[model samples]
Target: MSEVLGHHANEILIVSIVAVVAVGLIGLPGLFALTVPIALFGVVLLSWVAMRQHDRRLCEQCLLSMPLNPSERAVRLKRRFWMAHTGSEPRFLIPYVVVLLASNFATTTTIGRIGWAVMQLSMVYLIMSQSTHRKLQPWCPWCSEGGGGAEVDETDPVLPQDDRQLI
Candidate 1:
């Protein structure tokens, strides 16, 4: 999992640098109209590839468990965003922050601004979706290797032995 995270970190870093450079050289007018679709498609393709590489299966139960109400969904998204930035794997926050700062510094037109906003939202959605997926993977039927259901023991202690005893 760490290896997969590292690979994604490198990919995101490269994309972040290219995005900043491209935005800095906004000499071509109306370029966002042409690039936005391609960029969005690339984001989806890369996300699919990363999921396949990580052997993640979208669990039906997990998908259904997510809140359907817009307000609840927004709250959950906000929570996940905070978790991504503050959790143990906070390294992902670096590229996200870089892109955000670059967008503010370099976006000059309304179209460019909208495109950047969409891209940022999409990236965050994908990242948070994967985080949620991985967190529930231990119980995902399809992600269980060579089994129809999860093989992991649900009663296994997540805390240290001493802490488990205290609990």
Candidate 2:
């Protein structure tokens, strides 16, 4: 439980830091004037990449290094869920970039602010949904090896045959 919570906390911290920095960059005077939407889009992409890398590393470590344990299962399931959700990171960002580009061409204070708010809200919702699902069902064979309380050899051969077949 602690491990799962710790991982969640770390993810939240990273996301929060990235979001703050992105917002700060967007609010800069010269920065915004030069590349308002472009800068914002870049920040989003950079942050997403950073987060994805972090997730991948965590997943690899959990899958390879850790033993089959209850807490480990939770982490694996959470990681799998995140991977599935973020599988199309580039595709997901396209619409936002398009909106940003459109906004840049003809800026409107109301629409721009609302769009930013909507993006933030969506991000928060995604994080919350993942967290909730992790809590509800933390065991998954595809994610964790301890889903059935038995550790199976994931890399073992499916069948054995006589040596003559090889010849």
Candidate 3:
């Protein structure tokens, strides 16, 4: 998985970063309804690219799991958290993106509302499930291996031993 993702890491990172910027820009006063769909499209496109190839037959935890001891789990989770966040922001922001677009337009058709609601709920479920999986199993062997001892971001939180106990 890492080799596959690593092959396109730079390109995918750039796209996701652009999506993050677009989603952030969406709040500007002058950027209204148009920005909504554009930002939503950015997020949707990011999600599709990052996750579309995900095996539907298996959960993300299983797809991404790596076996590690307690200390290694701590080290690897801290190292890989940002990459996880990089992939997750688009997934988690769908609800806010849709609501912003809808509110900007004043109203949505019944079908549009239903669709947005469904998307929002689905993304929310996915985001929460991923977080829970990480909380339960902090180590990501693929991320640790792919990163090859990349410097840990100072801002990323390391789970304490007790916190790791929750899993």
Candidate 4:
């Protein structure tokens, strides 16, 4: 499910960014001024979808029953990183949309062009920083193979030990 959501979010971001750039390239004088704001709105939607997907994937992969014993410090740090990244999405996207909207009135001015460029750069930065960095590394073999060290009997709640019950 998260894989599907991530794919969709990326798809939206790519399409929206392309649309904004295409409008700028067409030299229509006023078209970019209008379309860029719409594209910025699309960026907000894209970011929300992507962040949700990232969280969902993290939860799915961190199952505790697998006994992989990830270090407590590492797990805590990763969780904090995820929270910070998720929290920043709205802050970046909202300003982008506002700037894009304001640019519409400036029409053929240098400010409008610069604003559009800034919006594109911001979108790229957000996607790379938030999504790529948080992606999970390779799966643990023990987790994937059902705790692959010792064979645990299906019926026993606990494993048998050398029955010496220490003195």
Best by lDDT: 4
Q: Mind giving the per-residue lDDT tens digits that candidate 4 earns over 126-163? A: 55444433342222232224443222213433567766
- Residue-wise C-alpha lDDT for candidate 3, range 1-167, written one tens digit per residue: 74455333334544554454344433356656456657656655655555434322234454455354555655645534554444356664665576645643432465554454444444444443444334433354544665643323244445566666677
TM-score for candidate 1, residues paired by index? 0.29
- Counting clashing residue pairs in each candidate, in order, gives 0, 0, 0, 0
Question: Model 1, stretches more than 4 Å misplaced?
Answer: 1-47, 57-78, 81-112, 115-119, 136-167
Better of 3 and 4 by lDDT: 4
**Tens-digit lDDT track of model 2 for 81-106:** 55434532678657756764564434
**TM value for model 4:** 0.41
Best by TM-score: 4
Candidate 4 error regions (>4 Å): 27-51, 58-97, 136-167
lDDT-wise, the better of 1 and 2 is 1
Provide the lDDT at 47 for model 2.
52
Instruction: Write down the lDDT that model 3 would get.
Output: 0.47
Clashing pairs in 4: none
